[model samples]
Target chain A: MTIEEESGYRGKAEEFLQVFKKGAEFTQDLLRENERLRYRVLELENSLNSATAGSGPDSQSQALIQRISELEQEKKAILDRIQQIEDENQDFANRYVEIEAENNNLANLYIASYQLHSTLDFKEVLQIIMEIVINLIGAEEFALMLLDEKSGDLQAVACEGLDRDEVPPVKLGSGLIGQTLQSGESYFTDDLESYQRDILNPMVCVPLKIKDHVIGVLSIYKLLLQKDQFAQVDYELFTLLAGHAATAIFGARLYSDSERRLSTIQGFLDLLTK
Target chain B: MADYNILIVEDSPTMRQLISFALKRIRGVRIVEASDGVDGLKKISAEKFDMIFTDINMPVMDGLKLISLVRDEPNHKGVPIVVITTEGAQEDRQRALALGANDYITKPIQPNKILDVAKQLLKLA
Candidate 1:
């Protein structure tokens, strides 16, 4: 062959060899990409399996926690129920204490009234009255004085923690007790010094009336070191005890007068028979 | 000799009864019933049962224990044992196989399916 023709042929062979080299490189690149894709797919599958495996425990734990929370709520409800029961128990206990106290007071009052039935002497009746009044009102001192209705004068019948000489012989319209008798109504004074020159501290004077007639007066006195300590409840309780005293004293007097009249009649009959 | 004498070991009263009923329907079958693995072992000691169909969860002892015990027995060295249970996990299947269980069947046990497995294991058809 000629030199030019031979050079052209060699150039064509070189061009073919370059194309074959490019094709081989492209095939190798494709194989490498295919291998990468296969590896990536395997990794994805493994990750999916691992994720599912991991989620299993998470779901189980969540379910367990949910069950535990439900149990805890039930426990809280039980605790609340127990607390409510305790509150009810406390309420019942307080009511029981109050009822017990009232029962004791009624028992004491019954005993005092029973003693009045056995006694006809005014002194004995007065002593019982003072005891009942002091216990009922929880007072420091108490006094009962009767009025001579004909002379319009008051005479002290029973005095507790006070000297008979110190207490003046009061008229119907003169002192605090006398004023109560005259008014025929109950009167309460927080400070005796506010109402009277001689008397000191808080005092209560209740007139003893039988059938609209003021027969006597009952007076309870307490030193007002703390004035607020005396309340309306104290006044109400004292008035109730005074009413019991009035009934007892009047009944005893009536019984004694009847006994005296019977004795006198018996003595007269004995003389007549002689 | 007969192809297989199958032992059905299960604890559930209903499942055991159902399996017994199904086994009776198949011809040329010698069937034995056991309530649990302990009863199954007793039954196995008394007779030469060819195959064992057992449930995984039972009262006295489980199917896994029965499988392991039966595998250790001299006469049942290569005898096929089938586990039937509600568990379908691959790990459970692998474990049953590892414990010498030849095959596993999941429940709501169809009678025809159990029969098919029995025929295949015994090489009846």
Candidate 2:
């Protein structure tokens, strides 16, 4: 072995050892720098968390949210209340209209009753009955038939929308009108839309009665063109006419007979005096 | 004294009474009745009327003829005339309108309808 060769190998080994030591020192410095940077990043994250906790979702905002929710509920309740009031108002309006109609019907009944007994003359009573039939009952074709007690037949005394001769005598208990008079009950057709005039089958037959003693029958063959059906007030008028008309007619007839007798007596007295 | 003077021309006393009764509901209004169109025309000639309600089937003179005659007069041309027609008498209603009737109410009249017509014609509240 040569000494020079051994010495050169030993110097190269020392230089290699120095370079390894320097590399270890640089690795240690880099690890220290990395640990310091990691701690600094952790501190900054913790501060950010603290700042967010301080600023977000405070007590005032929670109260405001609850208040807003309550306000929404209150608004909904108010809207519901308004709707209820509107429904009630609509009902009241409808009721008002109905009441008005009823009032008018009552007024019509009052007027009809007042006019029926406004006169006592035979002709005037008949005229009033005709008017009542035309205006109140809305009868276009009708006849007032008085029963001939001895003959057992009803003879038409007055007629409207028809000639007096056109209305033939109705026998007792024969047709609708006669039956109504015999029974002392009124007869009315339920459906008048398809009604066709038949003398035996009248649209309406009201018996003129005085305490269950029927004297005549008011036969309605046809109604006014506008009146296809009778109203509630019409039935009321019929009821009124049944009693008041009978009394009025009977009184008028008695008055007429008495007047005629009085005139005859006056004439006799005048002849005796002359 | 009345604020308005209205006339009703009808043959039936019942109808005249009904119309008068309805008209009485209005405040400060006077109602005058005539039995026929001829009588109505005489009254109209004598006095100025605010409104007139007439039946179409009146005797002596029909409502259409009366409306035409009233329109012929210079003073009564502006007066409002309302005709009462039967439900099926559309021809009569049209003729009345053509003859210068302002409006028409049907027979079997509701008093409210009459008042509505009166209010509209008189521009009342």
Candidate 3:
């Protein structure tokens, strides 16, 4: 009820209003700062999620890199196996070519021997056999000595690359070739000086047989000799050639005897008509 | 009980000799040889043979012709004719059986095999 007391109450009321307004402004500022902080936190969480997603791709890439490395190793191993197979194939091809060449040479030799065997003339057959031996075996000198059935002496019937008077007849049991004839087998001499002085170089001798009987001997002398020159294969080939030559010789003898008998019969008929 | 006569018709002397040699080994069997089909037919006409062993390939006359001729004859009808030859084709076997041949045997001939065939066809076993 006093004016002074009323004025004091109004001032207190005004001061209270001013304090409430300041408090509300402070609360609004605090709320704005809290919203900004919340936004920043959300941004950080998004960044973390993005980084985690990027790491997943990196792990997958690492796995792919490991698989690539394994594949490269496998590829390298396959390449090595292919290289080995190619090398083996090349080696086999080389061996096959060498064998084919040798087979061709043997076929040629056999064909030549067969051609020599078809002759029915004794001298011509002997000449063909000597020529075939010289050509096939690469021999410089060759001689065919026939054994006389009654006397058991070997006489040289054909000769190639030798002096006309140099060849000499010998007994069936005398020299190396003669001994081969007597034994009805083959003999090879790599060192000629060990056996006799007459043999000049390496030589091979094969006995000619007709139904288990020794008929003659075929001797071939090598002028150009090498190590492992005379093998069992060579002896077998020479023996077969000698056998064919003996058959030819026998056939030639039969043909000549038949011709002689026909001529003698014709002559007797002419004498009877006269 | 009775001596059975076998007539062999073949072109080859060696084959004829071989067949005759086999037939001689059988008891109560007598074998007569002929070099060709013509000679075989002549021998068949002259004698009454119990059986016939013939070859397909011959010089003068073939075995089929001889078989037909023997079949036409009244006395030689129903006589057991056995063809022993080197022909092994199915057509040859069928044709031979169709031509009144009792049996067919192929060569190179074994003596025991021939004897077995002969015994079976003649009802001797």
Compare the candidates by DockQ and give the number of the best one: 2
Model 1 chain A weakest lDDT span, ten residues long: A223-232
Model 2 residue A258 CA deviation (Å) reads 2.9
Per-model DockQ against the true two-chain complex: 0.00, 0.41, 0.01
Choose 1 or 2, whichever is better by lDDT: 2
Better of 1 and 3 by lDDT: 3
Top candidate by TM-score: 2
Report the lDDT of model 3 for residue A149.
69
Candidate 1: lDDT of B57?
71
Ranking of all candidate structures by their lDDT, best first: 2, 3, 1
Q: How do these models rank on TM-score, best leading?
A: 2, 3, 1
lDDT of 3 by residue, A190-222 (tens): 575354325422267777778778778877664
lDDT of each: 0.71, 0.88, 0.72
Evaluated against the true structure, the overall lDDT of model 1 is 0.71
Error of 3 at A54 (Å): 8.6
lDDT of 1 by residue, B1-125 (tens): 55458899976544554455556556777777898999999999998987888888778888778889899999987888888754334566677799999887665444455666777787775
Error of 1 at A235 (Å): 4.6
Docking class of 2: acceptable
Give me the TM-scores for chain A across all models, comma-separated.
0.65, 0.72, 0.70
